[model samples]
Target: MKFTTKWMAAYFPEYKGAADTEIPIHHIYTDTRQKTDRGLFVPLEGETFDGHSFLKSAINNGAVAAFWNKEKPIPEFVPTDFPLFLVDDTLIALQQLAHTFRTEINPKVIGVTGSNGKTTTKDFIASVLSQNYKTHKTKGNFNNHIGLPLTILSMDQTTEVLVLEMGMNHFGEIERLSFISEPDVAVITNIGESHIENLGSREGIAQAKTEILAGLKSNGKVIIDGDEPLLAPLHTREGVLSCGFDEKNKFVLSDCKMDDTGTRFTINQNINYMIQVPGNHNVKNASFAIIIGELLNMNQEHIQEGLSSIELTGMRLERITGKYGTTILNDAYNASPTSMKASIDVVKELPNFSRKILVLGDIFELGALSEMLHRSIADAISEPIDMVIAIGEEAPYIVEEMKKKELAIEAHSFKTKEEAVDILESTLSEETVILLKASRLMEFETLLEHLVEKE
Candidate 1:
């Protein structure tokens, strides 16, 4: 049964039931567009537009209930029959409701946070945990403040394990999400060069990621990346499980091989395992899951089997055939210099490629280190790439670095994505290995979509 108003009000004392004490909402929705019969719509504020304007349409589309800001005039379109979950702020109300749901649902929560691989790690853990239990995970990039709440509230009563990816950009964001989640187990994938603009340094980012522990279960297990020097100190917590390539890790990954298809590796105490993903980082992420599986007394084979199952989110270093028969490593999800370089390495290692091409856009949030970090990507382009297409303001520095190093590879800079795509379309060869690496704001996926369609 969907969450009734009764259980929601139990923990949310703020919840005042309908006139007779029955405020039944069949479903919850953040997007007004999806509002349907018995839908509780929470109108969010965005930078470009206010969702309040859409409330009328939401009800027209069958929204039976809505969370409206007291400031806005109630739209005439919504019939008097519908109830408005009135609040000072709709977002906070949604978060509070989700917080209440967690107390009621009591799922075995596994929260993951880090600078780089949280989503991948979350997916890996969910796959492994799903083998023996009903598992739910944050889908796509829904790991932010509002998204996390929605993800939590959506879990059913039967949800055995809920894998939540808790991502944060600034100080205390992870803390907020963690308090809402209060995970039974917390995983830190690694502290990488992501969101360095706002946080200032990799160390600062590490501190932000570690805030996941603030709301962790008192006896919860903390799984960390032992290979990351920045994260190594975090294992001081008792019952912490360290997983990485290092021998000292509780779950050590060795004999790793990465191909265009996937990576193969073996855990120290477990049989050989392979994951259908390209990167040592991914193997590390999967290793965390293997350790957790062992802790929960799950079938070891199922853990490996679970790792082998499940498709990852798109635009995350995905390998796909594109136009002109190009093999594209579409890594446009979001990027840092670290991830960009990793994708380059993955593409460079792929066999039988006639020409290696790196289509790199700007890495956002490097702060003062943006130029140096962008230029540093040139160092990663060793022998494999025939040409480097650098886009955005940082492209010039990347090209200059490539030239100073006396690399014979061709370097092209474009401020506009149109010119970049035109060059990619006309110059791309049949056997070229094209790697698309960029930040989410750069819209690199548009080029990827075009390239894929042309193929």
Candidate 2:
């Protein structure tokens, strides 16, 4: 049982019906279509639909109690014996209940946010800490205002550490999530061009990401990317440990090396670590998790064990075997200029690929800078990259820029993935490696269906 209806009444005193009952709420849901077991239904109001209109469906699906908006008239179909906690706003009430539940459990919270790698870093921290504690973390992309609270409410009562991923596309979103989670440790992975359209500039993006500090515990430690000049101001702040490749960082990473198996790096010139993921950028991500483990008193052995066994979310540098023994790097989960370049660099460094191909697609949410940013991706392509297949409107600009360089590389542009599929399939071979990267909207993963080796 997550909580009893009697426990909820303590905080939500303005209620009707059996508020004193000991009925246990095992789930919390918003969608009435999904059947729940003794759930607390939260009817959220949006521009298109009102969840309150579907309260009857929620009750039919096993919602034993609900948080009702005081402004809305309760339906006559709701039984008098049904528990209803009247609130000014159901969304705010959901957040309040989550915050209270988090407090009651009192887990050591670690909040991770940044323009990139936040989800991967959250997984790293959770995996490492779980070696010595009962850990829970935000699942999938549930890092927004509503998702963060739901993630908190989903944790088990015995969770010793709760790692929360806080994501935002505009200002103040991170701050609100921070206040809700109240993390004991805050990690800023790195600043990048993601959501630049909404946040204005890289500086604006950095400022928005730093809002995670708003709800940090009084004595909490903040780990950040020391190499990112935008985050320099916090480098000298008390309890802030910077982790990066730069020599000046408190937890410096050096001697970085990558191979077919994984990456190896040394931190502070003494502690050696290895991770299953590729990319030098991930080395910096691993350091953040390492510091968190250290701060929480996890031993070096356990930390290394965690890093070695990380299972990343799909499409972030995932390797797949293609139809003709080709290696496909599926970094198509999402892309910003910074991340796209980083993935490209990883492709350039991998050993034994006779040919390297890049299948690039348009990046979204750049607003006025969309064209310029898409064109800039060409700067990361050079001699080692043999072929470039550009798709989507702005993505063709990358092929245009590559032409201006007058290199001997093969490059093509297509308006859609369907146009490029036959060409991409023809390039698959044992000696070739292809990297597919673009924004989430591109749905580039769909192309994998035609490329993957079938049993």
Candidate 3:
């Protein structure tokens, strides 16, 4: 339940008086506002403010241990009895400490990374593994430098499974995270145009996602989406399990059907499985977990039960009953061209017949190719969609282009989210099955909350 100065000294040799300093640990905190008894405080120094200023407040609030930068002066408020691990860089020390803790527990780690579906796939993997073992997963989007380490350190000594989601907008972020987490199995959902601004191209994204392989043992299994052109070429090798809809994939999903409740797909055509998540993407997401379950030696019944009614507090597509009997599909967790199109396809197939309305917000991080990718959503438009309400600045190109194509469906572009939400909530009818989709940065969840809200 605690990370001691004794263990930290092993990683940060610069720490002084380690033998005399008493390490007290219960929780980890970055903000002094929430500091409490036995908390290990990490002061993150950035361009704006230095964390050394908060050391006094953190100590006053009962923070017992801290990562002090050797570059800064030691605060007088720090009591003589307290433990302080001096580090050349506090953030790097945090990562090293997490790795030390991971080795201490030795949980079965599953490292997952991709342009999309990392969160969903993590949910699926954790849910399936929980069928027979104690599990802990990355909470929501806590899959970055700080979250990954916290996830590993948070695991109890008995935690049999740890599903870690690795995300990056710049290069080497995943590489650093992977070093801390030596996953027994690595899964890559797919490599897409996300983070294209920073990474440069789709091919570059593949390289960044492949960084997950850095910490993986040579004999450990690597899972990938075989249907992805970027990932397909690298599929064949020892200890690799490719999962997708393609025949070449080691695990294939076929005979897929989606209705109001869930998606049903057969794995390798040997076992039919059902999951409460919609979209063809969810089928692939669930298949990755099913493969993991098989590797863990679980029965089909366990896999089936685990997949059904899977828990994701707020992720992917979820059906909700709105006011005036309007049905809403809140895929507002996040969106990209690939996922936006996939969600549009799922909307096209929903059972209850109604006018399909799309409320889309701008997707960030696509870089120079942003406009073209934004415009690609136009190609995904078809029958069943009565209107497309485009919100945010970048998304308007797609909406305007759809107008030029004379596609004959209603399309509206708004510069602000509130303006778009105002239109949909008032102008849309009861027969509407609205789809709220956008990137996480857009805070589309706020707009989704307003439209089709059932009292």
Report the number of the highest-TM-score candidate: 2
Worst lDDT run of 10 residues, candidate 1, spans 11-20
Instruction: Report every candidate's CA lDDT.
Output: 0.81, 0.93, 0.83
- Tens digit of lDDT per residue, candidate 2, span 55-166? 9999999999999999889899999999999999999999999999999999999999998999899999998988999999999999999999999999999999999999
Clashing pairs in 1: 36-62, 323-455
Encode model 1's per-residue lDDT on 1-455: one tens digit a residue.
Answer: 44655554454434222512455666778776673667677889889978888877777776655677877777666666556656788888888888777877888899998877777788889989999999889988889998899898777778989999998889999999999889999888888889888998988998899899899988999999898888877767697888887888877888888765678888884579889987777788788888888878988789878998966788777778777677788888888887777788777777778888888898888989988898898889878778899888875688889999999999899997888877788766677888888888998888865687742
The C-alpha stretches of model 1 lying farther than 4 A from their native spots are 11-23, 45-57, 68-88, 426-430, 453-455
Better of 1 and 3 by TM-score: 3
Candidate order, TM-score descending: 2, 3, 1
* Clash pairs detected, candidate 3: none
Q: Give the clash total for candidate 2.
A: 0
Q: Is candidate 1 or candidate 3 better by lDDT?
A: 3
